[model samples]
Target: RRSVRHAYCQLCDEAFRSQDTLRMHLKGEHQDRYCDTCDQARLLPSSLFGSDYALKEHHVQSPRHAYCQYCDRHFRTHEVLRQHYREHYVQSPAHAYCQRCNMHFPSGAALFDHYRTMHY
Candidate 1:
């Protein structure tokens, strides 16, 4: 990579060996005239001209597609929305009698124990 000899500020015509030094000069010297954000100064030798600041601003301000009134949060999918709503309620697995042996149990654990003792 070639070193930058002298960078001239288009606004003030001041010259420096580095672009960082020029940016500082522009930020400090002409704060009222320059509209760019000075806090995030770029030092790399690439064009700052290609960045899209408006798109970033739009994404931050826009409302999300899925919104939950219960949790007061936004999700991107239906499964996520359903799972989030379940957090407020207690969930238990439904159980029934095993058709093969006519053994009855209210929960899976009880059914497994009954089957193991009676059949196996």
Candidate 2:
């Protein structure tokens, strides 16, 4: 005789034949981690995923989240903002150039990397 096993998801009370499948359900579907709008279970459960997918897809398509419209580049965070400004400051000709390379860098991090490899 063969034994039958059932796996349960605590969040949605959904059951699956395998524990791994049930875990995936809890993590992906119930958690709303993938698509934010689809998080609502009361809404229609279409075989096709809807708005949630669309929103995430749109965010991915646009490269710039914290975007400078003039530069057409997206920044990872606020600290990057400071770094990017350095690029502008140096080009203004007021800032001192590095002694070794005579090349300008936008941020201290960029300048550090240039000095370490190029100068050394």
Candidate 3:
């Protein structure tokens, strides 16, 4: 027989086959952090994801958000995402540049790769 893995929710005394389901359950009665507006939203049992803050962080970084909590903004384009570091955003001191857009890379290899993939 194959063993099954279960994630137990302490809030409702229920066990789930997937931790994702348990996380989904957090948006139920006890906590409202989960976005019901999201297409993935579904009804599931509740509780035990450590804390509401963790859930908030997870939601903020999820596909629905596409946000940078550090910058406190949502990036509409990949070019903006690549220039996330505020200092290197549109030319401050970073040497990397691809025609109007300024981006910062940790190494020369990354910069070259970006140029080849995006500019060339």
Candidate 4:
């Protein structure tokens, strides 16, 4: 009889033939609700299952996650939050206001087309 060695996950009691598969399982199933502090300390699957509110509360209490009140979204970092703000709030502008022509357009695409044709 031949025996096969496999990587085992202690958290879920799952085993895989390859380490990569075990890692993928950990990341996909467990890391989604992980705690930043606990994760830094090598703690896997920090939050309990079916505790999304608890996870959200943890993020709100922690400084690592950036929360946007306007959009009601959470970002992992300040750079991501800035990028989101620029994309959805600042660069796009209001639906009708055009930055280049200093006028109002019926739609944002129309303003973009005006800028492309008239300004550019």
Candidate 5:
């Protein structure tokens, strides 16, 4: 095979060294996902992913999605998340909010946990 500059995966757009490596990646990483066709596909199978919820968590937490799983809401932009947190924390007396992270929690304990794991 001739040397090439880069080989891109149609599935996830991840670049590889060669076509063989890309084929290997597709057969391994792409095959493990719940979807068979496309890496961008969001169809999840409970039977296969019953033990692992990483993808599900990623869908909610990933900034690219502009979604807030805690509030069960979707925003137009990721910046809306900060606005939502500010409004929610200010309106709800029982809720806890972190200004630095622009995130809200149901309770102070949850916020503390976030601080310990993420910040401290």
Candidate 6:
């Protein structure tokens, strides 16, 4: 029998086998201390409340951030908005819209069948 040891992240309580993996976890999961909207631009930790305020400001001002008034939701990209639309509105029985060819289906089953037959 072999016993394997894993390096665990104290901040997120997740385990990894390597220091590089742990470092990546810390950067991605725990360190939200940079503005993602600004292409991971570095911020000064000594400033007022660090980068959280900058991230919020960027989200508010950036045109890339899209807002859905109907759902009161925000998306980072238009592609994400399209995905949200398809998931929430188009996939619903009342409004079935085909994602592939931009066709409208009367029902979700019809859309699924169309995808299975035409797409698949």
Q: Residue-pair clashes per candidate, as listed?
A: 0, 1, 0, 0, 0, 0
Every candidate's lDDT: 0.50, 0.49, 0.53, 0.61, 0.58, 0.60
Candidate 4: worst 10 consecutive residues by lDDT? 34-43
Q: Which candidate do you rate higher for TM-score, 5 or 6?
A: 5
Q: Which candidate ranks first by lDDT, i.e. highest? A: 4
What are the per-residue Cα lDDT tens digits for candidate 5 across 42-74?
333643433335555555655566655444465
lDDT of 2 by residue, 7-81 (tens): 765545666889667656755775442322222232335422346544444334544344332233446764775
lDDT of 4 by residue, 8-96 (tens): 76666777878767777766777654454334212344545336666656656667778653444787778988887667645665744
Candidate order by decreasing TM-score: 4, 5, 6, 1, 3, 2
Q: Extract clashing residue pairs from model 4.
A: none
Tell me the TM-score of model 2.
0.23
Off by over 4 Å in 5: 1-39, 42-55, 97-120
How do all models score by TM-score? 0.27, 0.23, 0.27, 0.40, 0.34, 0.31
lDDT digits (tens) for residues 3-105 of candidate 6: 4548776644678878667667667875665334333433345532245455555555667676443344667787987787677666676656566577878
Q: Write the per-residue lDDT of candidate 1 for residues 36-86, one digit (tens) a residue.
A: 432233333352322444323322344433444322355666577667545
Model 1 earns a TM-score of: 0.27
- Determine the C-alpha RMSD for candidate 6 after optimal superposition of all C-alphas: 13.3
In candidate 1, where is summed lDDT lowest over 10 consecutive residues?
87-96
- In angstroms, give how far residue 102 of model 1 lies from its true place: 67
